[model samples]
Target chain A: MAASTLRYGRLRVVSAVAVIGFLLTSCGGSSDASDEVRVSAASSLSLAFAALGSAFEALNPGVDVVLNIGGSSLLREQILEGAPVDVYASASTDTMAPIVDGGLSDGNATVFVRGFLAIAVPAGNPAHVTGLDDFGNEELLIGLCDVVVPCGAYARQVMSRAGVEPAVDTNEPNVRSLLTKIEAGELDAGIVYMTDVRSASGGVEGIEIPDAVNVAADYPIAVIVEGPNTVGGRAFVDFVMSGVGQEILAGFGFVTP
Target chain B: MSRAQSSHGPSRPPIAFVVLAAIAVVFFLLPLIGLLARTPWSDLVSLLASEVVADALVLSAIASFAAVTISTVVGVPLAWVLARVDFRGRALVRGLVLLPLVLPPVVGGAALLFALGRRGVVGEPLYEATGLVLPFSIWGVVIAVTFVSMPFLVLTVEGALRNVDVRFEGAAASLGAGGWTVFRRVTLPMIGPSLAAGMVLTWARAIGEFGATVTFAGNLAGETQTLPLAVFVALETNRDTATALSLLMVAISLTVLVLLRDRWLRPQ
Candidate 1:
């Protein structure tokens, strides 16, 4: 009985394999140029860097910019795994420190832009949260970045400086998540980069944090020592530091470091 | 003369079987061995003592268990329907039920956001009606895990139900048993093993569900973070804790598999 029952199920295994094979074949074939700068960056830079990628392509027609945006910690792990990457622009120096320490770079690390952390609330601010002090209220659902990421570390720094123990309802892995929470009103407020507030386009509103309680976030860019496109990586780094790069970064609300 | 004949009749190839098994064992065990060999055992106790690991493990267990329970409650009946009832669009429903399995977990998380996020189509009214939010909460982790892992239980139970003979119910009914009593007395006991196996698979899937959990629930240490989330966070700063967490996950999964094999799959 068992043997007969199993025989009737054999078609399922075959069909599953066929479906997987079809998907693999469809996904495996792709056509793109080889000279593209495979730049892996932090997720927070998605909106700004997407615009920058197109602008860079226009500036250098022969080169394509392949952007892999993710959490800085995750990006660093992939780089450590020896992924085919050229330039790595992280949201914080802490994430870049280990790679640079391991001699994974050609010593081209530089801070290109600075960002200030601020409290972002929904457009209408229904919670009536007046300032940073309101974050201490247990009733207010406040989201924050996890301490593993740069944004979260900065938020921690800001909170510690104010001597305020903010009641964090959740610690998101990235700023975008925190932004989503505030915009969706799942959270009354979240601490994110000024640029994030700009990119949110007023679905959320920003409350400028007092300088005494704000932490500065810096972007560190470097060329991988084992990068296939070392020349292009260095060139891209220089391009981002030049006047045009500053303009682009500034357009995203990044203050010149 | 009969004992002598029985001894040689068995003729088991012990040497070849053991050698082949040894090679397979090493192939599978080497990576785990390497992780253990590299673990910083000196600081292992303190590392585990860290509040973050504790929080993450507790959260993960709660969410994963909740997910498995929810999946079993909802999925088992659906499996019975699929296996026993001939209905219109049944095949399409089966395919649609497995959609979460085929779609990448990240995509599942994105879909969850569209459905349950504060600004979501359904979530908006829910929030406005009761000031309740689903995303970024402990409940969100359960929802994400259940969405991705329920299909495993459904498929398993459906397969088992299909194999269960309807004659047992018929026999019970002919003996003057009512339908509900017949089903309870006849059908349920036969497929108990498969149901247990399905529960184990569902639990394992829920425990390992990372992409959807992180994307939808976000990684809040005591609130939304589970073991996989803990492993991820530990990977960020401490390599030793990451390995420990991973080994713990592997150990739990292996233990569950062994228990299922012993308790559910052994021939009666």
Candidate 2:
């Protein structure tokens, strides 16, 4: 009786393994499709591109546009490492340079939009942060994107131009994270794109930096050369440069390039 | 013949099991091999000598050690109580203790922030009372590491305590030894191996923590950026530096595992 019971247990285990194997193989096989256009965009483009993605989808039915948004440098690294990205939109031309140099993209990346830095503080401005000079206040907790990211570099440029030495409390991995901290009231203030402050929708308030000290970030969009869906990739890039796309971006506080 | 076979060990006749195990081993080895292939050996010393690497190494060491120390002081007693005492909602208490083990570290970090961040539930009051802030500070790193690592120590020590023979402690107590003295003189010595293993495991987990530490403590060099956070940041800007930091972490973890091999790897 015990022997039969043991054999029955083994049979159950083997059948369970076989069923799991079938499910895994089926899942993998179904997910790989040329109709899916994977676009990797910078975090700052999240809301704008999301709107563009839906509008593009509505124009081109049967082609699903999946958006992968993250730090511009991080997305560039992923593309260079061979992530299956069809469209690549970066927050700065600096991040786009490597992709073009590596021949990962189609070599012609048009500057789609321009962004400027602004001081972001939690709602009600508890720290009373007014300008770039207040970033040097040691009593306040200040956050900035990591220096490698475009936003961080731009923020530093603005701070240097304004002659303010920021007393940084943390170097967040991405602009979104810096914004999150500011919105959460964990950070007294952080330097982020003007669009990000608008996206926060009252969670945080923005203090504009003067035009002289502010550096405009050039956003570039291109189609990956080796992307799985090159045809769909080109279409998406063209749509982004279209008048409707520009209008959508402008509504998000981005300046037309 | 069956008795002799049992004494030798259970017979391993399953070819499928052996094949699956080999695949599992290769799954772990491939990443290490990739890291090794990409590691820049010539620039390793200089990379390690750089200020960023040095600051991260020092901060990681300080936070990990502090985490282990705090876990030992508080976790051992909690484990003892769980193992020795029977109370209502004991299962619930055990579940709460194991929650961190199963929780995604990022979620755990967010939870910590909600409770201890500068404007957090308790943190606002704490700041009002003492003018102290935890996020983006070294203390935040230590606290985040400890919150995630303490469970390992607690689980190990509790298991050890459950396996221990209480008769020895009872006899010692009957011989005029106070409860604390009996525990210190008898229970501790008996569970020393497991305790050491638990502490080592806690230290390993603490040192390698990334998601929680980055989320709760924030990544700042010489303050909250542990080795894992440094590795993540370096990966974006400099690949070689990231590889070097990863190799250093692997070496540290390997040394700890090898040192505790007798207690953990070949448990009798």
Best by TM-score: 2
List the DockQ of the predictions in order.
0.32, 0.30
Show the colliding residue pairs in model 2: none
TM-score for chain A, candidates 1 onward in order:
0.90, 0.88
Model 2, clash count? 0
Chain B only, TM-score of each candidate? 0.88, 0.90
Q: Candidate 1: which stretches are off by over 4 Å? A: A2-33, B1-34, B113-137
Candidate 1 C-alpha lDDT tens digits along B168-214: 77889999999778767876677666667677777888999887888
Which of the numbered candidates is closest to the native, going by highest DockQ? Answer: 1
- Tens-place lDDT digits, model 1, residues A130-203: 78888899888888888888898999898888887999878877788678667766688888998999889879
Backbone clash pairs for candidate 1 read none
Best by lDDT: 2
Report the CAPRI category for model 2: acceptable
